[model samples]
Target: MDLRRLAVAAKPMHRTLHALPRPNCQDHAFLQMRRLATTDFSFLLPRRHAGLRSFSSTQSVPLSEVMPRDGSRADLKILPTDPDYLRLSVESMANMSRSEVSQFVFMMNSYGAVILSSSNRKEDRLAPYTMLDRLFGTPVPHDSMNEYGIVEINPANPTSINTANPIKEHLPHTDDAYTENPSMFCTLQCIQNAPSGGGETVLISGAELVAALSNKELKSLMTPGMVSLGRRPASDGSWLKVSSIPMFWVDKDSGWLQVRWRCNDGCVQSIDSAARPAYEQMDAVARHAIHQLVIPLVSGEVLIIDNRAIAHGRRSYEKGEPRIMWRKNYVGDGEIASELRNGLCPSYSSMFEGMWSMFEPKLVAV
Candidate 1:
């Protein structure tokens, strides 16, 4: 860890706790000989929910179809990139004065995420991913839109819910595992035209998901948790410290949110033991509470959901043709999050305290 960084982070952010919070409207891939071969239907899907229903589950709606997935055909089905979407471009936002920009960010921050669309491809500066990255640090690396695997919609693959491995889709989730200091926030720049299928990304408000759950369910989810990430075996025959983080942790002073969960390769095999219980809990409670997701999506439309307070996923693809999007994930900047943004990042000290605590038990006890 950056020691100079740690020195600055050790100080306590004592007075920053009272900052008012606000609300806002919100809101991967790879291939190497194909990570997923089309073999078993349950390849990495959940056994229970992975069982997609009929055409609704197996088939996806393609962009070419003027008919809705539900069988409603029309002369012109609305695409996510329709003229209405481009109207929300960042240039439109730029025309807003400084105060307006500040207010826009303030409103969006309070609400957790925002969306922007444009007719321009990735080059558009005001496009979804670029704007958010400029606002927040680059959160996480993911497959470029050019790399997103495209597929046709069929009933076999219903909603893009993860049953077995989450390492597949970068759902409308947070940037990292549970902690108060999340990365600067995640942004996805839509890149492909689905001609069909992949019409919308879906999300459930994390707060709403929690609110809708039963006490028994919530209790299990709130406990100190960890995640068991997987990786290659080491010389010692042990896998890498894939990662062990809680699903949720509010900062001691400031109430910023933090989270950690799996998407794609991170979700499968060789998970750390510490994270198992929490992962299981999340899966269970999240199962029933997930009905909160009914949001639709489209090309050029960007979806930014709070990883802390929301769970996100995608709609089924349009059969024979699929939509693709370029994704760049992010974590909120926690260390600089104090009301006094200029002060040292608290997480630095938090880091040393973490280091000292480990050895202090044995060193001091002596």
Candidate 2:
């Protein structure tokens, strides 16, 4: 039988499966069988590897060899390059044309992060916020801040160890990992730069990290309730927490991998002792030099990161140095502009479907 023809025939059945109400065991089994029938056929489709290659500049490296067994940081230095590190010579974020905005969206979706530099000198702090609102939607409000969800990252007190501190290195972490639904995207606009150097932004692609994982490690990371994240006070004077959460899962809607990880001391309440080794291995992979992109944002430069796809951190700068950044988190509108969406290959979903299929049974069993 021609698998292509079977795949085509299976779509109507899949739609019927979706139309049915929430599935019970029988229905779920039927759905899984149907999905396997269709998706397995995807393997026979004409593969378009070129589009996948164009999606990101970084290539997957062997996880076992990428870092040392002791998990120490590598001495290698990886330079900033292409799609991930873009330098736009535009005057200001507000002045960007429609095409430029489209370009930004495409690059962000493809590479998972982008650094844009502009010449706008006006102290209009709202510029970055407004631009983000236009692109991704409303910002996720800060725990205790203005309605705009803007948080200033400046060297306020040298003793503090939070984002406001410039003396300590901020380990790579996905913002809002404590929350059940973390922000889909985040932005950092450099209002000022540290004159003494340092404070460079560090980014690691979650896709690259996932690609390097062993099956055992991936399974351990994906196990729900194996981790506990969050420890913040809610409005009712009660502490908010996600007592059980997974470090990795595939978003059903977007077919994109989602990762929630924070290396902070208090944020991660606990990890399943059984899965501790895998969690530590993941951290090691993220910190490996080959997977890191260190970029220093200068004044008037804005950095946008797909929080769902990349983890970001900062290098410690000279204490009391005048470095300032405006930070905000945003939830996607679940819609991509036509100009940007058209550039992506339709077969992109096929690439992740196999991974999702591999893990679906385990997720369902849990």
User: Which residue pairs collide, candidate 2?
Assistant: none
Q: Model 2 segments beyond 4 Å from truth? A: 1-84, 120-123, 157-160, 231-243, 264-266, 334-356, 361-366
- List, residue by residue over 274-332, the lDDT tens digit for candidate 2: 87776777777777766777887787778877786678888888877888888887777
Clashes of each: 65, 0
lDDT of 1 by residue, 1-366 (tens): 554443344222211221212111211011101112111112122222212231322233221221121111111111121222212344442233344345334323333444665444444434343345444444553221223221212223322223112223434344434233444445554555445444455544344333333322322333433344443321233443344444434344432233444433333443346444534544544444233344344555665544544455554443545454555555544322331111111111221121211111111111
Model 1, residue 184: distance off in Å is 3.8
Highest lDDT against the true fold, candidate: 2
Root-mean-square deviation of every model: 19.3, 13.4
